[model samples]
Target: MKRDAKNLTNAAALAVFWLAGLTTVVVLGAVIGYVLVNGVGEIGLEFIFTNPHGVNAEGGIWPTIVATLYVTGLAMLIVTPVAVLAAVYLAEYAVQGRLVRTIRFAADTLASVPSIVMGLFGLALFVESMGFGFSVISGALALSFLMLPIVMRTTEEAIRAVPKYIRWGSYGLGASKWQTVSRVVLPAAASRIITGIILSAGRAVGETAVVIFTMGTMINLPVLPTDPGRSMTVHLYQLAMEGINMPAAFGTALLLMAMVLAFNLSARWLLRRNRRMQG
Candidate 1:
């Protein structure tokens, strides 16, 4: 009787888990299918290349695309080096103690903070106090705050994942700490670091609140970093909210999803290629 009860419980648990997985997959498919169905007909080369011109601004999103790229690129430039260096220090140089724990804890706390609050902070500090105004620079700075902790945490985890034996082996070869980190440790952690970067980049690309609050809704091309601009997310939000153009909004959403998906896949492919080459 006990054995039979155990088998029943096991079967019930398996069925529940299977149902949950199936539900998740079905929901994801529904969302993707909806977007693709609504947006595919609206996507075209002309819609992507030219500036918005017609009534209700129902033209292409060229300037917004450029601004999004500029903002995301600048944020990456600002955050990547600093986050990586911080991760290296925490993972390699710092003694595992209260201070290290505090830093990690602080990073976690900061990451948990609401993104709208970060946007407001950026509005106060970068846009007004720093006199950047509604510009790409302000947006990039604002977005960097969001990306920093993500990159740092992921990188530190990746670096710590490297085996202690590898470092000891490097030291066995009379290599300095910096030499081992630069030659052995970093190479091993590179793929995971790239994955972190890609994750942060995907977040950066889709950010609307921070970009909208900092960059302002300027359809003009961002010729300079200080120039005010609009990103795709902001444009999509405006279109959807104001009921200006539903088709264009759907197209923007689809394109945004595609950009993130393509970037993610490409980064993973590169990591796989690197692994194979190293092997």
Candidate 2:
């Protein structure tokens, strides 16, 4: 009777798991299908290449597209090295004590802070305090702040996932601590580290509040990092909220989705290639 009860419970759990997974898949498929169906008709070379006239009513999202790329690229450039190094220190070198615990707690706390709050902080620190005055650099810095905690946590977890035996073997081979970490462990954890970076990139791309607070709503191509600009997300919000152009907003949304999808797919393909080569 006990064995039969256990079997029934297991079956019930398996059914629940399948139901949850199917629900998630169905919801995601529905969203993507809706966006594509609504926006595909508006996507064209001219729509993509031309500059917007009067708040995205007459032309393409060329300027906002460029600004989005600029902000995301700059944020990644600033955050990647710092987060990776911090993760390495925490995972490989830090002593297990109050300092490490505090740092970890801080990262978790920062990760949970709302993006709107981060935008406010960015406005105060980067725009007002630093006198950056609504520019690409200010927006990028804000995004870096938003992405840093996520990247750091993921990288630390990835680094910790590397087997201790690998480190011991490297030490046995007379490799220094730095050598073992950089040459052996980091390589082993490269895939996960890249995945973290991809996640950070996605967040940077989609962020609206922080970008608006720092970057401003200048719907023009930025010639320099100091130039005020609008990203795709910012443009989409402006279009939808201000009732300027809904069709163009949908088109921009589709483009943003496509860009993110392309990036993820490309990164995955590269990771697979690297793994096959390593194998």
Judged by TM-score, which candidate is best?
A: 1
In the range 9-59, model 2's lDDT, one tens digit per residue, is: 999999999999999999999989888888888899988999987634778
Per-residue alpha-carbon lDDT of model 1 for 1-279, expressed as tens digits?
A: 999999999999999999999999999899889999999888999889989987688779999999999999999999999999999999999999999999999999988888899999999999999999999999999999999999999999989988999999999999999999999999999988988888889889998989989999979999899999999999999888999999999999999999988778977887788779767
User: Considering summed lDDT, which 10 consecutive residues are worst modelled in model 2?
Assistant: 52-61
Error of 2 at 111 (Å): 1.0
How many angstroms is residue 83 displaced in model 1 relative to the true structure, after the best TM-score fit?
0.2
Clashing pairs in 2: none
- Give Cα distance to truth, residue 168, candidate 2, Å: 1.9
Q: List ranges where model 1 is wrong by over 4 Å.
A: 1-13, 274-279
Off by over 4 Å in 2: 1-22, 270-279
Tell me the alpha-carbon RMSD of every candidate: 2.1, 3.1
Which clashing pairs does model 1 show?
none
Model 2 TM-score is: 0.89
